[model samples]
Target: MKVLMVSWEYPPVVVGGLGRHVHHLATELVEAGHEVVVLSRRPTGTDASTHPTITHISEGVLVVAVAEDPAHFVFGEDMLAWTLAMGHAMVRAGVALGKPGLGDGWQPDVVHAHDWLVAHPAIALAEYFDVPLVSTLHATEAGRHSGWISGTINRQVHSVEWWLANESDSIITCSVSMEDEVTELYGPQLPPITVIRNGIDVTTWNYRQRAPRSGPPRLLFVGRLEYEKGVQDIIAALPRIRRSHPGTTLAVAGEGTQFEWLQQEARTNRVLRSVTFLGNLDHTELLSWLHAADAIVLPSRYEPFGIIALEAAAAGTPLVTSTAGGLGEAVVDGVTGMSFLPGDVEGLTSAVREVLDDPAAAQRRAEAARERLTADFDWHRVAVDTAQVYLSAKRRVRHPLARPDIPQRPLPGR
Candidate 1:
């Protein structure tokens, strides 16, 4: 089988878990005797004139990274415009790939789109190739906003997601919670949605010998410092955690719009001294911290699926996470890792203290979590399940010209 994947982010341009997910899935699929081609955007600083489309083969997968169109739009300032411009560039690149003597005359049996970020080009290319369209909704805009499409941009994003869901021959969600969220938001008439959980490469993230600890018990939080990520809740619970385990320190890794806000929050709670904000660590640095930490905490209020929990597990670190969305499925409470209710500062404190107090029990849980990774969270299994979805999509029939009837509401001023 030949698969064409469209994503806004790929290796060396990773914005989040979506890039890693696509990379692993594509490589695993190639290993399984399938031809995979990924159409993605080039690194931000690369000049388009010199490198309009950079093609390379990595791990048996053909990657065509196209430079963004020369437009004066900023992603943060105007997301819709930036996305459209990106889609335009991707569409041009994809079209050129199908032409004679171009892109080695490569054509895909199925087109798989990662998210709404690449929806326009994916949809256009699938129709252009006259093949099945498969889409994976990594996260939804309405889901991020807790079901409220209040702002104009929020509604616009929601509309695009709805269109993608409806246009797809098959829809894939990383978690059961995400499947439910997509179904509810896109309505009942949408195509069949599959729950294919995200996976991790355990080999790359093995247990390492911990360096001798000296001062304080380290609690690591490795994720974006966003409001929904519940990083502030950890800062809120830090004082209480310190009361039990004196000198318990929390190290936050990753950057987001909430960085300054979270720092202010720690200061407000008077646990500023106990928290260290390590903004955006590389993969190697992340693994080092994962091995060195006493326990990894994930307190997300709206996680579609906690991929970081799997990474922590693979690193053999004890986990104290929230039962938010697919996190409940990822980390089995008492079996794999200790889990608590989302936004529960008391529960977060208790879980962390449990890991700090009884190191042996935490080690037992960490081992169990690692064992679970092979049976459930392996990348090979994910690729097999995803291929099945692609086959199902190919067998199904849908009108290419059909448009989704997404309802629109007038803006407040209008």
Candidate 2:
């Protein structure tokens, strides 16, 4: 099926798990024999130009990136300001395609949007082309940060999230936990929501198992080290964990607004020297650290779905995460990995200690994790599942009289 996919993040341009998730999802969709076009706003390069909504660009699948420059409008605290430009660019691409041979009067079977970032365009294009609109929300800010953060201007962000959930023909979320969040926040206005767990690419992470880093057992935190990620909790656990593990090292491998505070937290905990602030790393560095770690920790206070945990599992590294949102969903509680209560530094310390004190246990968990990830979280499976969501959305759009017609699909440039 011809699918128009929209997201704020993509590979190479990706900032966090969302980008990686979208890229893998699209890649797997291609593998599943579907045509996919991705519309994302990115830093402008020289080759930027007007184009058709791009067709089968991947092997047996088509992916296109409609780029836009958002750096100028994004200065302070506008980390995701690119989403606005991305929405505008996607709308422009759709309108341009409708003009002549570009669209060829042939509409895509459906328009699929990744998050609220592309909601405006998804709603617009679906209406313009008279097709179905499907949106997959990764998380709500309420669930992600555990509070109401959409104040004032960025309240527009939350409004858009609500708009998309209301506007789409159907909606999908990464976990059951997130489905509840949407229902709670958007009420009856939200579209029919389904639980589709996020997935990872196992091939890149699969390698000849190597011995983990010795002396200092490496613990990794690989996402944006923001407050919502509970990075400070990792630092707090370090003080006690270090007393027991001695040479245990925590590598903070992402860049965000939380860097300096984390650096300060390290000093406050007196585990500064024990922790290595690896700053921002490229994919190679992240993969190398993933391979080297005795355990990868994502002590998030809130996470919609923990793709990082799956990546760690795919890399044959034992995962330790808080029993929050999808972090708990990915872990099988001592089978694949272990979990601690949210914000429980003591519990966090204990979980980390289990893996650190018993290297053999950690190794066993990593192997089991690899097996579980390969069996359940493969990108190929994810692609097919997401394709099913697309099909489901289309079917629902076709039978609007059976279900109350959701007003989201045909709004113009909304």
Error of 1 at 113 (Å): 0.3
lDDT of 1: 0.87
Point out the worst 10-residue segment of candidate 2 by lDDT: 405-414
How high a TM-score does candidate 2 get? 0.87
Stretches off by above 4 angstroms in model 1 are: 209-214, 395-414
Worst 10 residues of 1 by lDDT: 405-414
Estimated TM-score for each candidate: 0.94, 0.87
Best by TM-score: 1
lDDT of 2: 0.74
Model 2 RMSD in angstroms: 5.9
Candidate 2 residue lDDT tens string, 340-377: 99889899999988887777787787778888887777
lDDT of 2 at 382: 76
